[model samples]
Target: MDMKRSLLRAGLVLAVALGAGHLMQKLADSRTHTAELATPQPKKIEKVSAGPQAAPAPSPAAPQVALAALTAETPKLPPLTLLPRLPVLAPPAAAKPAPEASVAPDCTPRLSLTATPRAMITLALNAPCAPGQRVVLRHAGLVVAERLDAKGQLSLDLPALDDAGQVSVLFSDASITTASAALPDTPLPRRFAVQWMADDSFQLRAVEAGQHYGDPDNVSTEAPVSARGGYLISLGDPTLDLPMLAQIYTWPADAKTTADPVIEAAVTEVTCGRDLLGETVQSRDGKATVTELTVAMPGCDALGDILVLNNLAGNVTLAAQN
Candidate 1:
């Protein structure tokens, strides 16, 4: 009897425990039903009007965008390309140079000349400018240009021009030589150039048969110059038209001065820039006195280049063109 009572009590306990579990389960179900009521499922609405319809409301939470779907919908981009790196190259080797040639120093010419008055000129090249260099010598109005050999030593042989004048020699550079000499056999009727001043004084530019007078102020001059039938005439002649006194340089006392003193006395000379004076030589009772000498004037052709008149108290030498 004790054992039966124990078994019935155990069965009652088991039944109570099962009833509690059933009640808890019913409560959980009730709570689930309440939540469902609070949030109802959506129902489709019927369209009212056709024209432009209002926009639909947004859903509570937008559907999560899938990574693959987003990637598919997005526009494709250009593919990226990387440039390759360049290599550093080495420079080329330098070439060998050629041997240089020797050069000479700069040589300038130096010249010297010796001229014996009235004789030819002697030229000497003291300094040689270079190989195959040239030198020039000028005299009167003529030029003599010559070249030198490698040695630079050179000499020039030329005929004499005038008894007393200048000769100019020029080298390739700086050295210029001027020489003067005297020669006994200088040719004449030489031409003489004259520069006359307003005061009737004159200067010699050149001695020539080549003198053609330049334009001078047309005024009267008392100088001992006369033109006979157009000799040395320029700008209507500016010489004395009568016999004038003039001095002759280096006149010997012994030479027969007047071939015919009385008749040849009617003359004029142009030299040494002296003015004119008409004079006479008179001898009364074996005594000579200078009287007023008058005679007929003759042209230039009648007399020689040299007109020597010595009997007068003053000695003067004159020149005329024959």
Candidate 2:
């Protein structure tokens, strides 16, 4: 036939170029197994063109896959709005009590003595007294007396007091100068009473009975009831004119007319018999006269020569003054 048809067209071109080189080695062995299975598989992105979409650049694997999904996902946070408050106080009160003071009382008493009577009671010391001081007689609450040397001088003993009362004597040491008196209750008379007679040529007479006369309203019968003739009489009752009597006289020292009349002048009632001499004259009718005087007398002492005649009846007559 033409050569046998030219050898079958060269085996049909070599069978079509061996099938196109086996399909290009099977598409390069499936692209080397898809790059070894995409080398551990994490690349899957598919966002084609959603208009305006270009933010894809951070990939070191996309920062390790967004730090492992931000360390495995747990954070959405926001909600707590401001908070804090606490404080309040009040409580306290209670306290009180105090008061009391007042004092005064010292009755005072102490006094007892034996012999101290020269009479001296002058106490004056209104404070500040020391020296065995003890004196009390409040109103007879009796403690009586003390105080010897420290001289606030107190030497008492006038007690026996009867009437005029009023006494307060207190001084128990701190010398408050205390002492008072107003005593006087009848009992201070030892006798003294006479009346009348001045002279009949004075003699002597003094006889008081039941003596005990002190304040006969302050006595002073003007003294002088006769002592020596020149007369001074005031016997305002010295106990009833010294025991009543009369006239008497005797003068005969060998009288040769010792100047005449020796005793003459008589009346009745005669009881005058106690030795009398010249210058005797007692005539109120009771008769007596011996005054013919030869005058020779000097200091005569015959228990006579006394002429104190307080006449005018205040009776005081101690006659005999020759």
TM-score leader: 1
Model 2 scores what on Cα lDDT? 0.31
Model 1 TM-score, 2 decimals: 0.23
For lDDT, the strongest prediction is: 1
lDDT of 2 by residue, 1-322 (tens): 7776777777777777788788888889999999888888658867586578679888565334334445666887898876655444444444444444554433333233322222112233322243444444322211223333453344333321212223455554343333344223233211111211222122322222222222122112232221211111221122322222222111212223121111221111221323223222331111222222122222323323323332312232332333
The whole-model lDDT of each prediction reads: 0.40, 0.31
Q: Per-residue alpha-carbon lDDT of model 1 for 114-153, expressed as tens digits?
A: 6533233565665555554555555443344455567766
Cα deviation of 291 in candidate 1 (Å)? 45
Off by over 4 Å in 1: 1-108, 116-118, 163-165, 172-177, 181-322
RMSD (Cα, Å) for all candidates, in order, is: 23.4, 28.0
Clashes of each: 18, 44
